[model samples]
Target: MRITRGLADIVIDSLCRGVFAGDCRRLSLRSCFPFLYDAECSKRSVVLGMVAGGDKTPHPDSPLIQRSKKEKWSQWSLRGGMQTLSEALESYIKDKGVEIHKDTPVEALERRADGRWQIKLPDGSVTADHMISAVPAAEMSRLLTPIAKPMASTLREMSASTVAVVNLEYDGEVLPVSGFGHLIPSFEDRAMLGIVYDSLAFPEHNRRSSSSTRLTVMLGGAWFESSVGDPDAVSKETLLSLASEAAATQLGVKEKPRRAIVTLNKSCIPQYTLGHWKRIDHLFSYIHQHSLPLSLIGASYQGVSVNDCIYNAKKAVQRLTGS
Candidate 1:
């Protein structure tokens, strides 16, 4: 597993603790921790292929993400984006010479007397000294029915929701912001959460040689359901209106987007509230006593960021491998 901070100025510091803290500090952080960062998410949002000065800074304190680096959002190409993230994971797996099964999903986990856990896939089962599960907590509870009661009970009490990503492509240059786009504060009470000037963030995307730049707008949490009832409608005009508003109010662009793509991820984000740590402690205790040799992982338990998911997964692997 690899840990990468997408935010520019941040490092692995002690930010999560502040949010987890239930005193005066936590009260102070309600607004600060979830800063409104309107940073660059695209390259075309800038001029002459130069990097925009947009600030993608996240709320200084996150309950799950580390706090040791500056918080500026950077442009990401599909290759650069996924490539940067996968590089470390691939390296670790390569060192161990493990081949991935990819699309084949696991159906069950059975622990044997020898202390190894067997993962049941569609066609067969693979047994390891212990297994790490990186699926979402809700899914894990559903899959591991024997202990599902407690897991489900705890998960239900926590708040979690999904986010929708709307991709809006245009044929012109976007007005430059500090780095990329910004996050919508919970207090804002707006349907759109934040946006990334995708083209301005990535140089390749704004290559004069290229025809158009694609912008990605994000509507997170409950906004998905509140904005539009139909997924198809949400993907279409719902995102377009928001993107158009930004372009007009922020960029002064009139030409309608040349193209658009909308991606909706159900259960995209996991919300961890006050009792997350204690609940996880108790949940893990139960798993340990049974010595089920099963590893459960995902954004649902530890965090919502990509880095958080990988970090927690690696931690599980460490304990499982005793490394």
Candidate 2:
């Protein structure tokens, strides 16, 4: 929820592909307009609505779609995407009734001979009968003495990736395309990964009613790997190219966006693979052997969805306190 470097790594890894192997548990948040995962009241679907016959757009594979359909997910409804880490946390906090002390990152943990754990912070330390940190696996591993950090190290070794969100706003209509715009398959050698017609996808924004529109572009995987440190510049160039492509190829409006804002999310998503659970289970087993009072939770392990984070946190807490 804090959107630490590690959490971002988790999300980017999940979304950008190749961070993990096997089929991804893809959820359709593809909508003509995306609603925050918690914005169920807005009556939005979660699937990208592409203009038929506009482009060689890539979508969730037929297998996945069939699965969704068989599960009774309606075809008429749209899906939601473009959710940020902050938005996901807000929804989780609202549901769980938890209060977050912003900027209060845990600094250190001391395990007592009798077993309790004490975590130090810049403000003050909190002693807990038991503690397991949910920090970035790398930092979490590094903080511990060599012997104790191995499990965390294993978690760190699990690969991850990042994503940069580019929100381009124009005062006038630009692209000819409607629906959800387009998604580039991995086979495409282009640097830009996916383009979402934000104005067309989600109709909730005040500006959506006007010719002015917002286009959200996601450039990542190979494109993001080079710009990991300075994602802003990379995202800017990527946005321009995408805008140009849309104007010339899709929209026919070539004028640049009146305003361009880029949000660089370093290591934004998690990459989960076949053996991921084995490593986590091994870590848990080792933790149990030590009987250290600690809990680890989040999208980095177990589940990447916001619901998974909250659900697993509660379950972990219940196990810890016998609640």
Best-matching candidate per TM-score: 1
What's model 2's overall lDDT? Answer: 0.57
lDDT agreement with native, every candidate: 0.56, 0.57
**lDDT at residue 301 of model 2 (Cα atoms):** 71
TM-score of structure candidate 1: 0.67
Q: Kindly report the root-mean-square deviation of model 1 from the true structure over all alpha carbons.
A: 11.4
lDDT of 2 by residue, 1-323 (tens): 12356533444333434322112333222211122222332323212212222223233346856788789643222334435556676888878986465688777777767666777789888777766556666666766654486686787766545666677787765656678666554444234555677776665662635667778766664445543335544545654565456444545556767777766666656655446656777778988897655678866676565545657787888787798
- What is the per-residue lDDT of model 1 for residues 1-323, given as tens digits with 9 covering 90 to 100? 11344321122112321122112112222122322112212343323122464444434345323323344333223545676668777779879999678789878766566767678899887878756777777767666665446655665555445556677777756454546555544334335566666775665646476566567776645545655454444555665677677666655666788787767766655555555667777678777776566666776665556655666676777776688
lDDT of 1 at 202: 68
Worst 10 residues of 2 by lDDT: 27-36
Measured over all alpha carbons after superposition, the RMSD of each candidate to the real structure, in angstroms, is: 11.4, 12.2
* Model 1: number of backbone collisions: 48
Ten contiguous residues with the weakest lDDT in model 1:
17-26
- In model 1, state the lDDT of residue 24: 19
Task: Give candidate 2's TM-score.
Answer: 0.63
